[model samples]
Target: MKYLKNSTDTNYSMFLTNPEVICRKIGNGFFLLSSKKTWDKCPYVQQISETGAFYWNLLEKGIQRDEMLDCFLREYNIMREEASEDLDYYIDMLIEYHYLTKIE
Candidate 1:
């Protein structure tokens, strides 16, 4: 796991989908598959939970990081700190796997 980036930069809306990644709805969750161009980077299929699908859609639509935090808290029975931490980690993993690109 990478160190969480809980920065205060208001401009950091964070990860959006990478061009070569495909998101497909599967039941209540989602499947993340790397395109041919990204096969060398991350070739495995990623199965995500329904909660992850929610965030994935949000990020795909360019939702702000703060809004993401609020959504997590409102939708799940978790503390704000836990939501923030978990979201940060999920965003980090998406980037690591080439499924998402961090907006500069």
Candidate 2:
């Protein structure tokens, strides 16, 4: 049997927002499609950062705060406090944009 090298840690459950919006992958990021009916003057497409994309993908399968902290810790040599702050900001942005939802 095969196993995923990095399985999701379920201590804290967080998921993506409803799949009401359309999305398309481009390079290392994603393009979110907004409906004209929802926002008559808003842009039809929105762009996100690479870090945002990473968290977005993780939200797809639900992830824990520690899991995300570990990811940042591995990707950079930042201190724990810095990592926590960054993660918090990332989550806040996603929440503000209605891209992420807390399951727990």
Candidate 3:
């Protein structure tokens, strides 16, 4: 499975509007607000779960999956197999959606 790595702090910029994180059940989608740009134009906006948002934030800090998995294992107390499966699923989804670029 492919994954992201080595992301730098420079890669991400904060949303100026401090966008409200809202989940829309109708479309099963997430949206954000932008204070820095025009209504139709904004930064790279994407819909992701709260957990995914957490991991994405960590990725911006250059955290790797191994480290994330360690944290997840400790926090969730789940089996390694289960954790690996879930991580792989999320990574695959991110890559498929073009939100993540595979390094190698």
Q: Which candidate leads in lDDT?
A: 1
Model 2: number of backbone collisions: 0
| Ten-residue region with minimum lDDT total, candidate 1 | 1-10
Give per-residue CA lDDT, model 2, range 1-104, as digits (tens): 11111223435344545455455678867776667563443346778666656655655545556676677678777798876776777766655665554454
lDDT order of candidates, top first: 1, 2, 3
- Which segments of model 1 are wrong by more than 4 Å? 1-14, 27-29
- Top model by TM-score, which number? 1
10 residues in a row with least lDDT, candidate 3: 14-23
Q: Which model, 1 or 2, shows the larger TM-score?
A: 1
Candidate models: Cα lDDT each: 0.70, 0.58, 0.50
In order, what is each prediction's RMSD in angstroms? 4.8, 6.8, 8.6
Write the residue-wise lDDT of candidate 1 on 19-77 in tens digits.
Answer: 67767896766888777887888756899877777887777766667776787778889
Ordered list by TM-score, greatest first: 1, 2, 3
Off by over 4 Å in 3: 1-47
Residue pairs in collision within model 2: none
The alpha-carbon lDDT assigned to residue 76 of candidate 3 equals 72
